[model samples]
Target: MRCQPERGHLVYIWTKNNQFCALCDEPSGVERDLCGPCEDELPWLHDQCSICALPLLVDGMACGECLQRPPAFTRVETPWRYDFPLDALVTRFKHQGKWPLGRLLADGLARHLLHAYGEGLPRPDCLLPVPLAKRRLRQRGFNQATLLARWLGAQLQLPVDEQLLRRTLETPPQQDLDAATRQRNLRKAFALSHQVELRGRHVALVDDVLTTGATTQSLARLLRKAGAARVDVYCLARTAKPGD
Candidate 1:
């Protein structure tokens, strides 16, 4: 049975089930690990760029950056804006080894994708999780993108090609970098596996978050170079333009 919180209460008590919200510790009122109130508080992205999915001032419009110079990916889809609690959740999932939180985020992303496809968004032939550098992989013990993609693939029944992409360079964290610097840092960072056959395929690159989009652009260019007909980006959230 489905349930929702009434109003303004942090501690929701549901006697029927023992599930608690991942974020609030309240009784879960939804199918997922999130309580209704906490889920509703997530920063959902509404008006966004058609190409990049960056939060925009108006709906159904591309941002000025995308209009000036289009990204390599054809389209981007994200369920949430990278802000507040969503950001905190992502940080915990990515850095703190919180697999359950990652699962919840991936579930939300999968639902969004399913709804988008139902609304006529073109589905891709395969999903590719952005590769992590060897050093980062060793340090983190897992690639968060791969974990998200695996969950999403199972939910969507799409093939996941985790081996198709490789990160050759170990770049510094992108958080402090400007757009131009991020792009340069990612140059030649991704290379396609020689064994993979991507010709004429539409592929979606999956990631935990999209900041300046430099990473996705680099990967999409590599995919296109490897003969992927179309490259799209799927991320959990899209950050608003830097300093916005």
Candidate 2:
């Protein structure tokens, strides 16, 4: 059985100069800002769909939607569920421009990927961060995915190519739409750079969160058509279905 973070875990607070927990302001005593106890209480993703990584009753099985129509990507790898403190942290990083909070989350993701690699997950040839629409980028002042990809690249010793994909159309937020509408909204929404050669290359798309996964599906379709041998998604969090 999959385990979930026990809510209401006590948070410890302390003052230190070296490192402090992002959640409790306690001394981390490690390179990362998150301490052990707080890390243990994180909303880790457990039983999930093998393809899209959606929360599921059983592990290593495809969800109904994925079985009916498979996504362009092979698999999704995310460490957390978009719940509790994670959602708030992501908001601070993505909306409020808290780079440190984003960095902490990215660091945790890097460690997760490394463990996955150790467990035989194939390392991708390159990393491509999902691009943001020009208007959204202007409004946000930065792309969280780009920062995540860069940080992951540095930690994993992989190459990050931010120029490979471009968001051509500014679509409404996927959160506001249902699954079907989300797919339609992403149609012709992304364009790939023709200059780069991707034939037979294994690439992973980096992003902050995977909600409906419509965005990654659209991007993966484009990459597969462009001759990428394999496509995977690397995101910090995966959201569950409503009331799941």
Candidate 3:
């Protein structure tokens, strides 16, 4: 396969002083190789619901809703709770097509997850980026989630397989809808496509952020239906549910 450059993945980074990292605005500090402000503003999920990944009280298990009706995915791992510098960075990457920002965030997530799950989290056989609808892909030029997933997969030593699952609907962006409405909108939005590769394999589904989780859940539902043994989600950030 040959690599083809496109509009979506043409992201660069800006230094702390706004010198010249075009697509991204990353700070430069000695520690952790991140800007000082960037280091502090990064939200770590110290305690959270095990299943849904919402920050929660100590020793929290699964959120009530998840317990009542479990999500299609077994677990989610995200270091930052969608906020602050992360929010700005993520938004810039998604809407502005800053692909470098996506890569930086994905690297941070891969590191955090390796520690959080220890050896408990099984290494996925391959990575499946939550696909974008064809129209969106045409408009955006690149799938931000795909950009992050590819970089993250390389960092984690996992193969990236973009063809395993797909989005069927040009569903309204989840950020535009309420929780219930978001879930409703995403219903049946994904379908399984690759059979020979996905059957009985474990998959790590990647996305830029996990909001209402409708998108990730939808993908997981389809992958599992296609014979995947397990599905785990890895997003750069996760929004802590209301009242969490």
TM-scores across all candidates?
Answer: 0.91, 0.91, 0.83
Candidate closest to the true structure, highest lDDT: 2
Instruction: List model 2 lDDT by residue over 1-244, tens digit each.
Output: 6365456653443342479888899888887788999899889999999999999989999999999998999999999999998898899999999999999999889999999999999999999999999999999999999999999999999999998899989998777788789999999999986567889999999999998988999999999999999999999999999888
lDDT tens digits by residue: candidate 1, 1-244 = 6376557663655454567888888878655689888989999999999899989889899889999998889999999999999999999999999999999999999999999999999999999999998988999999999999999999999999889899888899888899999999988888877577778999999999998999999999888888889999999999987678
Which candidate, 1 or 3, has the higher TM-score? Answer: 1
Better candidate by TM-score, 2 or 3: 2
True lDDT of residue 118, candidate 2: 100
Instruction: Pull out the clashing pairs in model 3.
Output: 12-23, 12-24, 13-21, 13-24, 14-21, 14-24
How much does each candidate deviate from the true structure in C-alpha RMSD? 7.3, 10.1, 7.1
Ranking by lDDT: 2, 1, 3
TM-score, predicted candidate 3 vs. hidden true structure: 0.83
Model 3 lDDT vs. the true structure? 0.77
Q: Which stretches of candidate 1 lie over 4 Å from their true place?
A: 1-17
* For model 3, the run of ten residues with the poorest summed lDDT: 15-24
Model 2 lDDT vs. the true structure? Answer: 0.92
**C-alpha positional error of residue 154 in candidate 2 after TM-score superposition, expressed in Å:** 0.6
